[model samples]
Target chain A: MATLSIENAGKSFGDTDVLKDISLSMDDGEFLVLLGASGCGKSTLLNMIAGLEKVSHGTIRVDGEVVNDVHPKDRDMAMVFQSYALYPNMSVEKNIAFGLEMRGVGRAERKAAVEEVARLLQIEHLLDRKPAQLSGGQRQRVAMGRALVRRPKIFLFDEPLSNLDAQLRVEMRTEIKRLHQTLKATMVYVTHDQIEAMTLADRIAVLKDGRIQQIGTPSEIYNTPANVYVAGFVGSPAMNFFEVTLERDGDQIGVMLPAKLKGVDTPYFLPLPAGGQYHSHIGQPVVLGLRPEMISQATTAAPEDPVITCDVDVVEPTGADTLCVIRLAGRGAKARVSPAFACEPGDSMEFALDMSRACVFDAETGMRLYG
Target chain B: MPQPKGGSSHRTVLDKLSRFLPQLVVAPSFLLILFFVYGFIIWTGYISFTDSRMLPAYEVQGFRQYFRLFAMDRWDVAFDNLLVFGAFYITLSLAIGCLLAVLLDQRIRAEGALRTIYLYPMAISFIVTGTAWKWMLNPSLGIESYIRGLGWESFRFDWIVDKDMAIYVVVIAAVWQASGFVMALFLSALRSVDQEIVKAAYLDGASTTRIYLGIILPSLRPVFLSAFVILAHLSIKSFDLVVALTGGGPGYASTLPANFMYEMTFRRNQIGLGAASAVMMLLTVAAIMVPYLYSELRGKRHA
Candidate 1:
C-alpha cells in the first residue's frame, strides 16, 4: 500500500553506534527481508522504520511524506512480534479486533472483520478462547490476524516465526508468504535464518556489524556474493576456504594447488581469476572459496582437467549423500559425493577440484575476486 | 562371581535412608507449627461457646452472648468501619501502586531511591508505625497544629477526631503502609514482561497510553490478582494500626473485626461473644475467598 524509504539513517547509543548511515527503500507490495546474524543491527534498522527507535541522523519517509517526527500510531503500520505478543487477557476474537476497535470502527463492522480474519487464518473455532488457551502456532495466527484485520499502510514483522517449533515455523512461514501474496501489502521481514530469507524475500538485504554487506535477490547473493562473508554466510554446509597463491603458468594464469589437492602430484593450475585481477599480487596470499557440492565424484568430461588427489580422513553417509573428509591445501575439507562411494576413514579417494567454479577472495580484505 | 544385585540393593536402600534420615530427624518443627498455629486456633474456637470471664469459664450459655453482641452499637459501628476501610484502602493502594509502577517502568534515573522510599513503610511494624502516625495526626501536636501555626487561622486535618471522617484517617494510614508491597509486586511483573511486546505494539501504531492501558495492563492480570489477595487480607485483619492510631475511637469509627474481637475478648470480658464473632469473621473472610478459590482452582484444572 505504501513505499517506505530510509535515507542515511544512523543510530548511536551514547558512544557505540548500532546502525550507521543506512539507506534503503521498498516499493509498494514488496516483501523486503533484513537478513543478518544476531547483533548485526538488522533489528535496530527495523525498529527505526517502525518508529520504536529514534535515528540520530537523516530522515525516513513513508508514502512520500517525511515521517521522521511522526508518532508510531500516526505512521500507519502493523507489526507481528517474534513472541506473538497476543493479549493474554483478551479472547482470540478480541485480539484480532483490537486495532479496529482502537481506530473507532463500528461494533458490527469490527465483529465482521474479526470473523473474516479468523476464517482466513482458519482459527474460527478459537474465537472465544483466550491467547493462553491456544497453542503456540494458533496464537501466532491470532497475532497475524490482529495485524491483518487492519489494512495498515505498512506491515513490520520481527522474526515472527522464531518462537514456534521447527515444524510449526515451517508451516507458519508458508502461511505468512501466502498471506503476503493474497494481501499484496508492503511488508518488511527480519530473520536470522537464510532459508526463510531465500524462500520468502523478493529482495534480501544481508547485513553485518552496522552496514549492509549486499542487497539483491536470493540468487544474486548466492551466486555472486559481494564479499567472502556474504558468500559464506548465505549458503548452508557453508562454502569452504583454501589459502593459495597466484602463479603465472604462461599466458594463462591460475592459482597453484597445494600437494594434498588430489590428482595432480606436482602442481595443479586452474584459471587465474579473469584478467589482471590478482596479477598485482601474483605471489601474494589469497584464499579460494569452494562449496561442498562443487567437488563431486570425478566425471569423464576431460581426463586432463584439474583433479586433486587426497587420502580420505573420514566418511559420513547422510542417506542422500556421503560427506567425505580429506586433506586439501594441508587443511581439512569436506566433499559431498554420491552414497555409492562406501569410503571408510582410512580410504584414499580421487576428488576433482573444480577451481573454475570455485570463488577467489583477497585474504587481507576478505572481498571476493572473480567470484 | 556371585550376583552383586542383592548387595547393591542393600547399599542403595541404606543410601536412600541416609540421604533422607536428616529430613525425618527434622520433623519436630512441623509438629510445632501444627500445635502452635492450628491447635491454638481450634482451642480458641472451643472457648467461643463458653461464658468465660477473665479466667476461662466452661459453662454453656447457649447463644445468649451472641444475641447480645448483635444488639451492641459498637459492634455495629466496627462492622461498618471495616467495609469502609476495606473499600478505601484496597482501591487507593491499587491506584497509587499501579501509577508508581508504571512511572518507574519508564527508564527513570534514580529508581532505587524512589523504590526504597515507597517500600520503607512495609519494613516498619504496624504497631509502632501506627503510634507514630497517631502522634503525627493528633490535631494539636502533629500536622494540624503545625500547619495552623503557619498563620492559616483555619486548618482542620482532624479527620482523626471526627466520628464520620475518622475511618478515612485509618484508611489513609493503611494505604500508605501497604502500597509499597503492592508497588513491588507490580514492578516485578512489569519488569518480567516481554519487552518485544511493547515494540510490537509501537509498530502496530498503538499510542503510548493505549500501549500501557490496553497491552501492558492486561498482561499484568496474575500480578493484579496476587496483589488484590494480599491487600484484601491486609484490609480485613488490620488490627494493630487501628488500635494504635485511632484506638478504635471517635466512637468505634476506625475499628475492624480483629480489633473488635480483641476488645470483646480482652476488655469487655464477653468471651463467648468474642469467639462467636471471630468465627463469624473467619466465615465471612472464607465467604469472600470461596468464589476466588473456586475460580483459581478451576483455572488450574482447566490448565
Candidate 2:
C-alpha cells in the first residue's frame, strides 16, 4: 500500500477545464471514493492519479515521491475499467496473470498468483473460460481478480459496477467493500453512484463541475452535508429544500412555514435549534434542507419535538418504510414514515420534524449556514 | 364509414398487395441471378460431361474430356502456376494488409490521407494493374533500363520473361491490386475494437508491441479468416491479370485455370475440357467460401 497525494491537480482540453484544482490525499490503505455526477471529472482525476492522463498542472506524489511524468506502467497502479475490459483472446486465468507476466514475474509464480486470486474470488472453475463465455457478474469477478492478483500499490476503479444489473451491482458492491477490507489496499474509485460511495468509501470527495464540493466521512456526508448539493445528492428520495424567511422571536430563532402545508388555516411557527451562525440570517431568506428520514411519524410525540400536520399527497411504499409526499412552503417534500403509521393520499397525518438535525443554507450562495 | 363492408374488403386486398410489394420488387434480380449465375453453372457442368469438341454436343463422354484435360502438359503447368500464385498472393496480402492496418491505427496525423493512398490501388481494375506492372517489369522499358541508365550497368530485372519466375511477377501484381482492399477491411475491424481494451492493456504494464501481439491482433482472428476467404477466391479465379500481364507466354508458364479455360475453349476449340476446368475453378472457390460463410452465420446466430 502507498500514500497518494494530488496537489492542486488541474486538467484542461483547450479552454474547457475538465478538472480544476483537484487536491485530495489518501493515507495508506485508505479507500477514497471520488463521487460525482457524469461530466464532473471524477474519472479524469482518477486517470490522472493512475498516470493515464497528464495532470496538466500541479504535482502527483506517491509515497512522498513526485510521479507526475511517470508512465502508467511504472506508476504501480492497476485500473478496473467500467467495461470490465477482459482480454477477449485470453482465458480468465491469463487475464488475471497478464499483469504479473508484464512485470517480468516468473511463469510458475504467475500461475500461483492466478490460482490464489481465482480461489479467493471463488472463480477457480472459470479459469479456463474466455471472457465472452462468462456472465456479467462472473466477468466482474474476473476483473476484480485481475486487479487483486497484481497486488499493486494503488487500485483505480472507474464505475466498475455501473454496467451490471441492479442485483449484480449490489452483489459486486459488497464484494468490493469486502475486498478492500481484506486487502487494505489504497484505492481510488470513481463513480456517479452515491450509494456505492456511502457504503464503500472511507472518505468520499463529492465533486461537481470539476471542483470538489466536499470531502468527509460517510456519516459526516449524510448527517452534515457540506452544502446544499451534497445534502440532496447523498440521500435516497433526496433531501427537501424549502425557501423560508428566518425570523427572530425574542431569543428563539425559527421559520414560519405556510399554514396551508398542513391544511390548516393559520401558519405554524417552527423553532430551529439556536446557533450564532443562524442568528445573522434572521429576517433574511434562507434555504432549509431536511432529509426525509428526519421527518417521521410522531408516534411518541416527545414534548421537545415539533409536530406538523401534513396533507398526504402520495404514499410510496418501499417495503420497510413508506414515503408520504406532502406540500410544504408551496413545494412538494418527501417525508419518511414507518409503513404502519403511513396514512392515505387524501388524509392528513402528523409528522415530527427533527429540527435538531436540519441544515440551513444561504439562499444566495447555496452554502451551508449551519446545522 | 357509410360503405364499411365493401371498403374493408378492399382495404384487406390493398394490405395484401403492400405486403407482397417487397418480394415483387426483388423478383427481377433474383430471376436474373438464378438464370445467369446458377443456370450457366449447371449448363457448364453438363457440357463437361459431354464430348463437345469445337462446339456444343449432346453425346455423353463419361469423364473422357476430364481424362484428356488432366493428361495435357499445358494444363499441368497452369494448375501448378495457380497453386504457386494463390499461396503467395493470399499470404503476402494478409501480412502486408494487417501491417498497414496496425500502423494506421496509431492515431497518427494524416491517417486519412495515408489510408486513401494505400487503398487507392484497389480501385484500379486488375487488368489495368496487370498491364501497368507489365510495362514496369519490361527489361528494356522499365526498372532495368532506368537503373542501368543511372549507372548500374549490370542490373537486370526480367521476371516477366523468365519461365520459372513469371508466375511470381503475376503474384506481385495481384498482391499490389488486392492488398489495399484487404487493408481497408482490416482497418475497419481495427477501428471497431473496443478502445477500453487497449487502455486496460496499457495499465496492465504491457508494452505496445506485446499489447498488439498478445491482445489486439489475436482478437482479430475473424477478420483474418474473412480476408483469407476473399483472397483465396480472387486468386483461384485470377484470369484477366495473367492474360494482360504475360498472356501465358514463355511457353504457357503463367496461365491460371481461368486463363487455361479461356485458351482451351475459344482458342483450341476444346469446349468440354474448358468446361471441366471452369467447374474445377468453381469447386475451388466453393471450398474456401462455404465454410467461412457457414461459420460466420453460425457465430451471428449464437451471438
Candidate 3:
C-alpha cells in the first residue's frame, strides 16, 4: 500500500542518543522487522516512521511523500499494539469500529467491516464482550481486528505476540504471516525476539548499540552475517567463537587451535584458502565462527581434512538431537549431534569442523572476515 | 511440606487470647465508628417515619415526616445539585488527571517537581482548599476585583452570584481539590503498566492521543473507577467546601445535600426531616460505593 523510507534517522532524548544514522527503505507490501534487544531504539525508530516521535535528525517518507509534518492518523496507517490496547469500556464491536466511525463510515459499512475482521480473527463470539473480559490471546485478536477495520496503507506491530504464551506466540506468528499474505499490506513490526523476526519478516534489520548491524533477507542474515555480533546474536545457543591463527601447510590454508586456550574448547584447523577473504591475515589471530548445527560428530581419520578430538563435558539430549558440550583446547565447545550415539558427561568425542561454511572474523574488530 | 508443630499458626489458645487482648484495649475507639455512627443513623431513620418534635421520642406516626421531606422544595434542589456536581466533578477530574499522568509518565524532565505541584492540593485539607478558593472566586475581594482594577470592569466573575450558574462553581472547586488525588492514583497506575505495552502501542502507529485515550486509559480502568467513586462520594457529601466558599449563599444557589442536611439539623432544628435526608444521602453513597467495593475486592481475589 505504501513504501516507507527512513533516511539517516536518529533520536536523542536530551543528552542520551538512543538511535543514530538509521537509514532503511521498505517496498510496498513488505514485512519489515526491526529486531533488537531492549533500549536498542527499535521502538523509537518505528515511532519516527509512524510520525509519532519526531526525528531528531533525518527524514521519513511514506509512499514517497515526506511525513515529517504529517499526523499519524492522517498517514493512513493502523497499528496493533502488543497490549491489545482495546478500549476497556467499549465492547469488541465498538473497539473494532472506532476508527471507521471516526472517519465517518456509514453505520451499515462499519458493522460489516467489524463483522468481517471479527470473523477473520475468529472473534465473532466476542463481539459483545469488553476487552477486560477477554483472555490475552483473544484481546490480541480484537486489537488486530481494530486495525483491520481501518484498511490503512500500513500496519505496525510492536511485539504483539510478546504477551502471549510460547505456544500462542508461535500460533499468532503464523497467523500474522497468513494475514499479510492475504492482505498484501505493508507492515513494520518491532520485537526483541529473534525467532519472531526470523519467521515473520520479509527483511530483518538486526540492530545493536543504536546502529543497524545488517539489513537483509532472513536467509542472508543467517548464512552471511555482517559482523561477529550479528552472527552470534541471530542464532539459538549462539555460534561458537575461538581465537585461532591462520596457517598455510604447503598447498592448503587453515587456522590451528592450541591444546587449550582460556576456558572455551574450540575446533582446530578451520581451513580457508589463501586467496579467500583474509589472505593478508596469515599467521594472524582470527575468531572462528561455527553454527551449532554445522558441527558434527567426527568419525574415522582423515589426513587431508582438519578434525579435532575433545573431552565431552556434558550432554543435553533434546530427543531429536543431543547438544554435546566438550572440553577442547581447555575451553568449552558445543556440538549438536545425533541422539543415537548417546553421549554423557566426561566422554571423549570427536567433532569434525566443516570449513566450507565456517566463518572467520577479526577478533579485535568483531567484523566478519569469511562470508 | 513438613508441618510446623510450633509455628505462628500453631499458637495455643492462651497465646491467641493474649494476642486478642491487645485488640480489646483498642476496641473503645471503634465504638465511635460503631454506635454514634450507627445509632444516630437508625434513630434518624426511625424519627423520619414519626411526627416527633425537635427532640425525637420512640413514637411513630407513620411516614408523616417523610411527607414533609418530600414536600420541601429545598430538598429537591439539594438532591439535584448533588447529581449535577457529582457527574461533572467525576468526569472532569478523571479526564484531566489521566491527561496529566500520561504527560508526566512520558519520562519528562523535572518529574519530581511536577508530581509535587500536582499532588500539593490533595495534601492540603479540604477546608484549606475551600478557604483558598472562596477568597480567589470572591468578586469584590479577589480575582474579579483585581481584574476590574486592571480595566476589565465590564467582565463579570458572577458564577458566584448567579443562582442558576452557582452550583457549577462548587463542582469546579471540588474538581480542583480532588483531581490532584486522582492524578496521583493515575500516575501510580501508569507507572505500574507493563512498560512493554507502551512500546507495543508505539510500534502499532498509534498516535500519542490514541495511545493514551485508546490504550493507556483503558488499561487504567481500575484506578479510574477508584478515583471516580472517591470523587463522586466527596461531591455528594461535600459540606466544608460549599459552606466555606459560598456559605450556601446568594440564596442557597450552591446548596448541596450535606449542607442542606446540616442546615436542617443545626439551624432549623428539623431533626426528623434532616435525618431522612441523611439516610437518603447514605443510600446514595451506598448505591455507588457497594458495586465499586465489590469489584475491587473481587479483582484482588482473582489476581
Best by lDDT: 2
How displaced is residue B104 in candidate 1, in Å?
Answer: 1.4
Docking class of 1: medium
Q: Evaluate residue B165 in candidate 1 and report its C-alpha lDDT on the 0 to 100 scale.
A: 90
Q: Name the better of 2 and 3 by DockQ.
A: 2
A best-first ranking of the candidates according to their lDDT comes to: 2, 1, 3
Relative to the true interface, what fraction of contacts does candidate 2 keep? Answer: 0.85
Quote the B-chain TM-score, candidate 2.
0.95
Which candidate model has the greater lDDT, 1 or 2? Answer: 2
Error of 3 at A345 (Å): 1.2
lDDT at residue B51 of model 2 (Cα atoms): 88
Q: On residues B13-97, what C-alpha lDDT tens digit does candidate 3 reach at each position?
A: 6687898998887899888778898887787788777655567667777777778888888888888888888889889998888
Q: Output the lDDT of residue B297, model 1.
A: 99
The 0-to-1 C-alpha lDDT of every candidate, in the order given, reads 0.84, 0.90, 0.81
- Model 2: per-residue Cα lDDT over B1-303, one tens digit each: 377898889999999999999999999999999999999999999999998879989887799888998899988998999899999999999999999999999999999999999999998988899889999999999989999999999999999999999999999999898888889999999999888788889999998899989999999998999889889988898889998899988779889899999998998888999999999889888888888889989989999
- Sorting all predicted structures by DockQ, with the top scorer first, yields 2, 1, 3
